[model samples]
Target chain A: MKLPRRRPASPKKTAVGGSPEATRAALLQAATAVFVASGYEQARVRDIAERAGANVAAINYHFGSKEALYLEVLRRQASERIERYPLPDPAQSATPEAALQAALTMLLSRLLADDQRGFVPKLLMRELLAPSAALPAMVQDVIAPQFRQLSAVVTALLGPRADAATIQRCTFSLVSQCMFYLFARPLVQTLAPQTYDDGAVARLSAHIAQFSLGALRAQRELLERADA
Target chain B: MKLPRRRPASPKKTAVGGSPEATRAALLQAATAVFVASGYEQARVRDIAERAGANVAAINYHFGSKEALYLEVLRRQASERIERYPLPDPAQSATPEAALQAALTMLLSRLLADDQRGFVPKLLMRELLAPSAALPAMVQDVIAPQFRQLSAVVTALLGPRADAATIQRCTFSLVSQCMFYLFARPLVQTLAPQTYDDGAVARLSAHIAQFSLGALRAQRELLERADA
Candidate 1:
């Protein structure tokens, strides 16, 4: 489906002219569209402002600079969206398969529900491809913490005997499974010629969960084999 | 480390100075760098020619159009690179673990070693991220055939008992393990704080092989459980 065309920002006013916060919100939304369309390096503040229907100066007033605005856009879109997917409560589930399923479901739902035209993942993917000076801050403040929390959940599920490399690979596999749909969607669609509808999504989720559980189970086996 | 900047293309002496074939090769190489840097949508033939040290007219003379040049780059760089990583000989071994390990080693080596300023994977990643009109031809000519061949190897290693989904997931896991490293190297470096030197490469290879074997073993167990 084609995304909505970019619209010029209206002056700071919601019908009767809303608050500055409203204007700021509008500007951020516009920034998301512009960034997704042109990528961070190519996105211009002027276009973003125009799309928001706010004055060009509004971006400076609200976000301080284009870079700051971009960072804020990422913070709002990527981090906040991820936060919506609450981590699985450990007290409720003791089984590794249950915890793994919960985590996989949360991840798949988040990836699938994100409807912004290439807003979240594309931004992150771009940063991954050609990192900028600001990457350390982004990684530290946003991404790393989430992954660490994920690792904790996974560790709890796998119990005390899991080795570091095993944990790392499992973590990589989980993230990679979710990302495959996003990063490889075009290629998959081209090759598979199947629409990834709800049915397809269900099938994919089940496959990923099973694949992950099996990997974890096998890790235990390998550990036991090593010991023997 | 920063990659070496593009060298100016020497002037054409004869059809052989760059014979028409030499001219074509130089153009494609230059086009690869430009495509990698700017992506297909934004890359210009003039820039490619300048990068290759040839006149803008040379592109028209050689490839006929910008799109043709782009396709040529994909064929030469992406498709040919895939071709280079030939399927592991089936007679070499039979165990699923050994077969997978051999295939993964070949895949990872090709992926990591070909990271010449992100030429090959970057191009493929771009196509994956945003498919263009030329994608079908690209996929048919370059990507699909290789994937099919790889899939057949995976299917054989998996034995006759594994169903289609299991085969697919295993194939996905193998590719994910290999591609994720190149795709997420920046994040990996940031989080791991370890150099991806020879030792790290060995560790990573071991990690992928073990992880993959674990997944395959898990798949077998799941199939058994289901059957029971």
Candidate 2:
């Protein structure tokens, strides 16, 4: 039986070269498409090999197993986006507020800007809803580090007044606000009905930054008042 | 072909009386389980009928068509939750702050409180990610009205300074904050590792209320300062 096809055929063609590197690259690309279309478990290794025009033996030779291939796909997809939209180094921004805004802008760009054709965001979202065995590795390798980076920024913004838990919750708030755009895109489109054109990421980034910074500042004040 | 079963058999037994009303209720319950498991298009009327202990012809006799049955499931689920967690009557609170807090608390309760076994929340989350034909009607019947109600509360809180678009965006911010806990539950669980016990809803509601109210107040102050 033909598996149900959800995504359009990828325009990217596997390289014709019979070299090992070329075959491996083709396998990764094919695996990504199959994984995105069929999810991790339903994705068949045979189908991926057929799509890549590679031998079944090539998969095990290159990646050892389907699980390893999936992990590689996730790691590569996540790293590529992070490299493209890296948060600014701490010293780059003049102030914590500036740093926070830059971080939100980059984070929004990462989450919403390239979401069309993006695989990691979709995979991670699926992982959130019905987590697979890969979730712990993902949280460890990707999510935890991102959380710590955001936590640092929240700490700087909230200053010494807020405790660790407060910082953590505020970090969740900031990330959640940004993610809502991607996860709830359909509802957002229906309600707002605007062109999510090139300017959308920057525009949304501004709104989130303004709202979040204001909240962080307010939280700090409340904590200060309580201390007094 | 044996269909993959995702959910355990619902404890709700079809009424033995074989009355039309009883049959319809049973179908709704079975359809909710099937729809939630297989989604809209893949869900089979035959399976739903068997699960409900009714005849396949009974579905058409009661609800007219599969499309109608699906819509009825969505409608009933949405309305039940709304009725249970209706937004504050506008006059119920003396201050907009109190009103907004009450609204947030109720909204959070609605979104997060009964979500564990709730069919509607699961179905709605599916709608957000992979929208089906019923999306427009669900948006029109359920989402639009909810947006308007939230808009009213945001308008009252933002005072006269913020415009319609600002009010709309702020409303999205408020809602996105509450929904994050639901959509991102696994991530929240992985990072926090705490039991989402009974108190989780009220605690999360308090955090969102504080963060959002603070943002709205700050937004108003910014606009007021600009006017100065």
Winning model by TM-score = 2
Those runs of model 1 whose alpha carbons end farther than 4 Å from true positions after fitting are A1-27, A41-72, A157-161, A193-195, A199-203, B1-24, B42-46, B115-118, B153-161, B193-195, B199-205
Global local distance difference test of model 1: 0.71
Taking the tens digit of each residue's C-alpha lDDT, what string does model 2 give over A1-228? 553232333233444255667789889989999887667766899999988978888999999999999989888887787677666787788999988888888777777765436677777777776677878887786677778878999999898878988898899999998889988888898877793667998888899899888888899999999999
Query: Per-residue lDDT for A1-228 in model 1, tens only?
Result: 543323433333332134677678889888899988888767888888877777899899988999899888877786676566666674576765776677667666665654776476676677776677767877776567657766876686566788775676678767777777767777777766563765665677788787777667677766777777
Give Cα distance to truth, residue A140, candidate 2, Å: 2.2
The DockQ values of the predictions, listed in order, are 0.53, 0.47
Candidate 2: which docking quality band? acceptable
Error of 1 at A178 (Å): 2.2
Q: What RMSD, rounded to one decimal, does every model reach?
A: 6.5, 6.9
Off by over 4 Å in 2: A1-75, B1-17, B41-47, B54-68
